[model samples]
Target: MGVDLRRWWFDRQRLRGDLLWGVAGIVLVLAATLGGTLALTALFPGLAPVGEVGADPSPTVAADAASGLAVNLLLGWFFGFAIAAFQEETLFRGFLQNLLQERYGRLVAIVGQAGVFALAHFGYYPVSAWPLLLVVFLVGIVTGWLVDRRGTLLPAGIAHGFVG
Candidate 1:
């Protein structure tokens, strides 16, 4: 049987409520990410490497970010709201986590999905960026927890979008 889009953790009747919760989730995740990064840096000073090669963006990227603020804004909004929030939550929290929770249980599913989520970023980041990976994994756990608690992907998606 094909998937029922109507039953995919989306409630049209609760759109306003979900949007409010989504905003709150975004703020919460932003604060958590910043605080967590600072805390980790304080605890492990070595994690903050100095004078890394290719750490800075290329001149082209910098120029684009500087001159194309409007374009960047639109693209960022689209990716954050549509791709990261909607698509990722649908895949990770709505489908994968639900299936795992059904087979293995909530705790295992949450952690397992989180690990997978973090690992999925391995190709994008360098291996030396362990602290970033840790933060990503923690965020995944928090997002998964939000989905489990709310029985919806809206807040999780919003939070994930903000994190991205």
Candidate 2:
């Protein structure tokens, strides 16, 4: 399996029906969130924080940021992004998504995948990684939804990077 990541992902895709619902889920989340936010802010004008942009002319932070960006790109692209996406979607969004979909509904499956995604990250460092638990889980649901829509994991992975 170590060398068969593409084949494994393709096989998994063949087994699951096209993932259109997954994409819808991602779109719904974004749309719903934006709509609710706008509605609430219109109703209660002073709720949202307005911040002024402060210019940072320091080259040190800029250099560090650029370097960090470079490193992240190298790792995110070259270090088997498809494999990582495949493994994650297979477990959280494939097997478990189906189970949740059958047991409850499509929403449940998306939520279940998100939950698993968060927990997986939390397991990496239970203490310091607590914050990731919430973040990745939210991301999981979005990715799961993407998988449902895209009919494959590759687009989902690419979208994840695009959003990041």
Candidate 3:
């Protein structure tokens, strides 16, 4: 409520910028995730796939992965923009984060938004995966920070959609 509404405006230029930034952010995150997975497997040799030690590249697996990526890319954009990203970002970052920012500042607002975002996931899902909850929380932090930096939800929304 205390934040300036003008800063959140989404004109044509801002939309283009948001799309670029969103893609950039997701690409960086993906690269980091891939690197981390590689490092983890290296550190824990036992964690490698069963019977996959020193195995040659599998064309079938590669094809399957490519197909899956194609499907996921389409679904991600649809769900992210149409449902998940737009709605969740609006509520958590647009409303809650902005409300908290006025009183508690950016750090608290971002964290608080992220905490609530994680809790929402925890409640919606039936799984007992605590690590997933942490991942959701981290996502919230990233998206919230995006909103703060851009003063709009488009970048985070686009990124969220891609991540989905």
Q: Say which prediction, candidate 1 or candidate 3, comes out ahead on TM-score.
A: 1
TM-score of 1: 0.81
| Model 1 stretches astray by more than 4 angstroms | 49-67
Model 2 lDDT-worst window of ten: 48-57
What stretches of model 2 exceed 4 Å from their correct place?
Answer: 1-72, 125-129, 161-164
| Candidates arranged by TM-score, highest first | 1, 3, 2
Top-scoring candidate (TM-score): 1
Candidate 1 displacement at residue 101 in angstroms = 1.4
lDDT of 1 by residue, 89-157 (tens): 788788889889999999988998888888877766566657677777778888888888777787787
* Candidate 2 lDDT by residue in tens digits, 50-114: 22223554555876899888898878755435556556666666667766877998887788778
Candidate 3 regions exceeding 4 Å error are 1-9, 28-73, 124-126
Candidate 3 lDDT over residue span 80-102, tens digit each: 77899878878899889988999
Each candidate structure's TM-score, on Cα atoms with residue i matched to residue i, is 0.81, 0.53, 0.68
Better of 2 and 3 by TM-score: 3
